[model samples]
Target: MHRRSAVTVAVAAALALLVATLTVLTGAYEITPGGVVSTLFGGGSGTDRFIVWEQRLPRAVAALLVGVALGGCGAVFQSVARNPLGSPDIVGFTTGAASGGLVMILVVGSAGSQSVLVGTVAGGALAAVTVVLFTLRRGLGGDRLVLSGIAVGAMLAALNDYLISRAPIEAAETAKAWQYGSLNAIGWRPVVPLAVSLALAVPVTLALARSLRALELGDDAAAGIGLGVTATRVTALAVGVFLAGAAIATAGPIGFLALAAPQLAGRLSRAPGIALGPSMAVGALLLAVADLLAQRLLSPFQIPVGLLTAAVGGAYLVWLLTRAPRREGARGAR
Candidate 1:
């Protein structure tokens, strides 16, 4: 890696540490870093043990894993689609995942991990297919693909809201939380699948790193260089969709991290190509910080982490639109 990439990674690692420390030490049961360390190694009081092992530790790990997945997925999508706005949330994948989870919650009356996983995967796959079909005619230009995704996403959003409105009061309440995205009640059990997925996906993403680089060059250029444009795009999209769906399975539609992380990392690293590694690190950092804020900012009445992300992401989106240079092309209908 270049020195700049190395430095960016180091900075992100440091930030992750700081956020992790803060997250562990700032809760109602505030424990020292030393105490947290000792407890993990089996040398603390029962209360400390319970707080760290049973509660905070799992939550912290979940934040890290979720952040990494969202960051990686977001970076991949942005790179493949060649559009800053091409994220799971923008393209309907997150909404689809949320819709799937809601279906399980409302129709099946099941909220188990497996149910959530299945629903999210199904919904995300459906959205991915819709996006691919809509954009395929012109072979995935940035603006065309983004507009198609937006249309599909809006339709899914409307469907999700309608379903939520029709559900029973209790189901509505449950679906409401899923819509906003929360990490509450998550434990080690669900972490296993997340870890397994990450382990499976990261190496593949890294291996495709060079292909992604070639992809940054337009399709014709990429093909000239012996890269299978269609295959590369499909592989990247699959990885992104799977990661996003898994994330939704674990923690509803946590929006914006996927969109903002790569942009933030790009700004931070100032690298030639998209900063995938740094973005993943920054994404993990962002989610960790957001989760920390969600835990403490509202205190006893904890808000969903997605709400915090949405607030930050919405502001960032406004800034991007204002600052981004306008292009004269066939603009899609709003």
Candidate 2:
């Protein structure tokens, strides 16, 4: 990694730690930073330990991991599509996962987290297959993949709305809450699995980063250099799908982290192509900050973190769109 990129990762990691500390200390019981550190290392009071371990720490960890997962996957998606708008949120994987969870919640009425998880994973896999099937003949690159994903995502989104509308009011309420995507209900059960999944997937993503970069030189040039264009692209896509799927299953599809994290990371690092490590770090920081704000923004009320991300993400999308023409013009002038 470049010195600047490494520095970006370090700064993001430091900020994420600071925000997580704040999150652990911000509850009504009010523990000191020292208390939090002490509690983490098994030296604090029982109540302090309970609050930190049982409540706040899990939530904080969830935010960080989900951010990492989304950001890494977002970077992969953009690299594969060769477009900044190619995040999972745009491509439909998130909506598909949400649809699965909604199906379990509304139709099957499965209250168990395992059932919801299975539904989400299955839903996400289905969406990936749908998009790939559409673009298989043309291959997974450039505008084709992005367009197929958009179409799949839109149809799935409509299906989600229909499922919610047809369900009972109580079920509909539950589904709606899940759709908004909050880290509020997160605990060790979910966080542990998410962490494990990322632990496995992150290395695979980083391993593929070199090939993905070469792919930017176009399929013909990549093949000329002995790169297996189709296989590498598919593998990268699968890894991206897994990362996004795992995150959506764990966190209920938090909006725009997958969309914005990689873009922000690229700008911050100023490195060629998507930097997965920096993107993951940036993602972790972004979510930690968002969760902190969500908790403190309403004080005792404590709104969902998803709403905050969506509001910010919407603005980022607009900025990206307006900036694109200018970027293209600059390239033309050069």
Task: Give lDDT per model, in order.
Answer: 0.86, 0.87
TM-scores, one per candidate: 0.93, 0.94
Q: Candidate 2 lDDT, tens digit per residue, 1-334?
A: 7788899999999999889878887776777878888898998999998889988989998889999998998999889888899988998988888888888888888856667777887888889889988998987877888888899999999999999999889888878887898988577987877888888999999999889989999999999999999899888878887888788777788999889999889899998866888999999999999998998887877778899999999999999999999999999999
Q: Which ten residues in a row have the lowest lDDT in candidate 1?
A: 325-334
List of clashing residue pairs for candidate 1: none
What is the lDDT for 82 in model 2? 89
What's the CA error at residue 320 for candidate 1, in Å?
0.3
Give the distance in Å from residue 265's predicted Cα in candidate 1 to where it truly belongs. Answer: 0.8
Candidate 1 residue-wise lDDT, 1-334, digit = tens: 6568668878997888789777776687767888888988999999999888887877888888899889999998899889899888888888888888888889888888888888888888888888899989798658888888899999999999999999999889988987898887678877778888889988887677789888897888999989999988988888888889888888889999999999988888888886778888898899999999899887867789999999999999988887664432324322
CA error at residue 176 for candidate 2, angstroms: 1.2
